[model samples]
Target: MFVQPMWLVMLSWAVLFVGLASTAVVVVDQFVLGYRQPVKVMEMVWPVNALYLGPAAVLGYRKWGRPQSPRWLDRHGSPPRRSLNARTTIKACHCATHCTLGVLIATPVTYGFGLEMFGSTLWPEVVGDYVGAAAVGVAFRYYTEARTGGRRAWAVMRKFFMRDLLTVSVFEFALLGWLALMHFVFFHETLRPNGPVFWLIIQAGLIIGFFAAWPPTLLLTRRGVETELLSTPQ
Candidate 1:
């Protein structure tokens, strides 16, 4: 019998609308206006980020993402080197894309099937999210390292996947905890993929997740993990 306050519900709708609009901006810029990234996966990355970050994601795409376009590289004749801060942001988002896809898939599957473990859907969702992220993370690593760099798959596993596992685990922590306490704890009955407030929680959680993961990603980048692979302009 609980109802979300009128202003809260309206705010949720407004926030979700902005996120959608932001995602559209990135899509139009990439697909329609042709500011496509040289790395095809980043086309997915940037827009997905916009789904949560709204105009801030668009701004990041404009600054860091746009310059990676082939057209820009051709005009400039070289890729401009980004600062450590910029590179760290890129690295976090690169890994975060995996987490995003994982959670998006997990949330619905758990909800739809009425799956639960340990008296909460969170446990199963966590498993699905982790497995999905690792699967995609390994695939991305294979593409970037084993296939592109010509390293052996095992070597790539040792070098990339291990580090990525740590990064993504840290990345997922805050968002997962947030959902557990704020969304699932109070509104468990109401929040679903079909609900706007669900996405509102997701949106806010991802922003928190971004901040949570940033520090470790920056440390890893400074230590020269995934540096060359992430640095490729093409």
Candidate 2:
């Protein structure tokens, strides 16, 4: 009896739906309200994503650990250099779709769903924040391929590690920085208990965000090994 990899598919599907739906909701709400409430929307959508994604990530890593998902990776690595061919297109779609979803999830979890939002009855905010983090994953894959080259995604990931790292690091810091700044300047709230120490803490957060965003950025890029493993499944 051949065991199916349906679990992976299901998890990916859930992530895709949650991300697209959340992003759509935010877009619609913004159009209706006539403003860019990126943070509020993230707070609502990302938490739910994190709930599922965190587990999915663990399961996926375990399933693909050491051995790795050879089949998935092979589709990316195989040569003969096909352009938007059916197989290649699907692979690209998978990379782009899930990555975009990942980014959408990461954003809110880091910025909004901290201990402060813990007791608030606004559960949507918590849910949305993690969803945004997942979106970060999606965005990372999407932008890397789109900006570089889809067919050569793996190669680009390998050769341009620092460049890719910089891209995602900057993105993570900018979004968090913007959110923190808004809270401090507009809402007059401070993360630091000490007023004078607040600026230092914010600077530290900017630094941490870059660090947190780096590993995942590196993982997605380095996962190119998975392509080689996939094609020559051991």
Candidate 3:
């Protein structure tokens, strides 16, 4: 049996707790406050963000996740609404959050199966990341759109499949690029999927991925391929 260091164990538990607890808050808010109706794909996005962002995710929900209404307008005094570019950035962040959680879940499972699926040592892990991320991204879009009511079932499914493929590809591209650099250049060691260092590095990758996905998200939104959940207050 292998013994892990005390600090690493503690950090792992901490991350787990934060991930679960914060995700719960998003779920509860969605159901209790009826946020699920107005915010497209928010049911999945907020919870996924909570996994890595913890309390910051809660703050983001309050600030940007909720739909605008008269009561909200009166209280906040109608602050300048977010521009299309800003909303595009938020959507990209939401897409990246989904991918981050997916990769986190897939990494360990794929590692257990060994890395021999492809000729390259890291290819198997990369495949797992793409599969997991794409699966989650498409499923999330399906569920959210279904709940909100939409076009024909086949049409919704087809749209989401294309949307997620484009968004998740960009997200994974940036995320894996950063991880590859860290592993080959800076760390000079193989990354252990279950290790605390790997978690930290992946978190940074997710943040970078948000930026990388933004331009694509902007184009998608402008073309009406993707919908913005939060609206600018008028």
Candidate 4:
């Protein structure tokens, strides 16, 4: 009798390789193709959909879909203020500044190094792409929040579905599916395989994805402060 390799074992190994390869590609692509504007940062939408929203939806539905307050509220006795200003801004400024600086430095380093090592320049283009995407993100967030009249980010997303499972599921699925297909199918012809175009696609997808998702990230991360303002004890 012939013995077959275990599917789980093969999948685990494949996943490990994919993770490592993807990381290396990102590092190289960000500096090389991104710097060159080979692909718009909006391209990042595909990967983020595939890697983040896709998985998050599955896990969130399975784990946190029921009616329940957040753990922080449960532990800290709800929020205290609607807006965070002054001290909070000062404290956050340092971290945000550092993060921005890191991106600036990383972009150039990756671009220069990848060019020297692999004969491609991507950093500058990616920076431009991300800038555009970030602008879009900001606009989307502001418009949605303005419409909701101060609802939290998660609340806004929930409201978009009007609390209907079919609505939320369909929308999320479509968004993710569109991104995935764009990256894998529609953009396949544009990918240069071994060339710099391949690298640019990686950066673009991430940039676009992050841009589209930034509003959610901001709201989710700052929900504590917002809740505090609304729920403060009289």
Candidate 5:
């Protein structure tokens, strides 16, 4: 029997705690605060961001997560709210969140299964990351669209698939590119799928991918391929 390294174990626990804590914040905000009006995608995105960014993500949410109602009364007898473009940032954040989470899940699973199934090939990890990210991204899009009702299942799925493919691909490309550089150039060590260093690297990649995916998201929104998924406050 072999004993695990203390550092590795500590890092693993840290990752687990951060991921869980971030998820908890988003869930509570969505269900308890009744901020579930817009699309549920944001709820998912926030927690995922929190997973990587930790307290910073939570702070951002407190500052900019929900639309701000105006202090002055409007002609409609309610305060005016922020424009949809403001929330578009949140939407773009969702793209990054889903892709990052997918990759995080896929890397270790594929690494383990691939070692067992294929006996030490890198392809399994690569393929798994793409497949997982694409699957999650498409699923989230479909769920958001489906909740709107009045659309056929096949139609909703197809629309989401087409819309998400390019964006998700871009996100993965940026993320993997950075990770590859880290492993091959800077670290000069074999990549450890479950290591804490791997996760910290992934967090940096996620931030990079978020910026990379933003333009495409904005374009999609402008082209009408993507719309506001969040519900308006009643």
Candidate 6:
């Protein structure tokens, strides 16, 4: 008996397809066509963000991301100057990508397996989201640490590990609140991940999460609490 309005369903699907298509274009550009990012972590970050940001992701990639690539630098001599907003945004995205991966993976798995805790899927969904984000976030740290190449590399990773945990907590807290509002108040639980409304919900969630997490990221960066994302590249 629960169903989205026909028009909402159609619009959601249209947005979903566009997001997927944008992701495809990013993948093709990064892997198939070799617009590879100079920094390793961003290779994953750009495409992951595209899943929700749609064509806006592509435009962000073109303006900020692509110019830092080896291909672009080789062609243009040096990357262009960018504002602090660009730097702050890209750094926040490093945390966001892992967070996004965790949520997207958890949502369907919890639903598909009928995974429940207490009375609903929310508990396991949050658990899975944090677990997945931690896993990937550690890997991102390792990649940067590996480039540092010293006995102190592990120490560097430990600092990054702690920083990421903090960053992800803020990111997830905001996103979880937004999603709870959507799930409990706005959309209800009528749609599965296979449907457009489901993806639409999460897409909206991540976009809002970006803004939610940005201020803390800016404060951390400006205060020198975190440095690797903007400073390191490979």
Residues 1-234 of candidate 4 have per-residue lDDT tens digits of 222236633653454445345434433443353311111221232222323223432232222211122433455553344234322322122222222233335445545455322333333333433343333333333343563385466655443333222222222233334434544466542333243333333433433433443344344335532211111123
After superposing candidate 5, which stretches have Cα over 4 Å from the reference? 1-23, 31-38, 67-80, 83-85, 115-122, 150-153
Off by over 4 Å in 2: 1-103, 107-160, 190-234
Q: Model 1 misses residue 172 by how many Å?
A: 1.4
The predictions' CA RMSDs to the true structure, in order, are 2.2, 18.9, 4.7, 18.1, 5.1, 2.3
Of 1 and 6, the candidate ranking higher by TM-score: 6
TM-score of each: 0.89, 0.25, 0.71, 0.27, 0.73, 0.90
Give the C-alpha lDDT of model 3.
0.69
RMSD value for candidate 6: 2.3
Ten-residue segment with the worst summed lDDT in candidate 2? 225-234
lDDT of 6 by residue, 88-145 (tens): 7887888889889998778778988999888877778878988887777777777766
Clashes by residue pair, model 6:
none
Query: Which is better, 2 or 3, measured by TM-score?
Result: 3
lDDT of each: 0.79, 0.37, 0.69, 0.34, 0.65, 0.79
lDDT of 1: 0.79
TM-score (C-alpha) between model 6 and the true structure = 0.90
How well does candidate 4 score on lDDT at residue 215? 42
In candidate 1 the C-alpha lDDT for residue 211 amounts to: 85
Clash totals for all models, in order? 0, 53, 0, 27, 5, 0
Candidate that scores best on TM-score? 6
Model 1, 164: alpha-carbon shift in Å? 0.9
Pairs of residues clashing in candidate 3: none
Show where candidate 1 strays beyond 4 Å: 146-153, 231-234
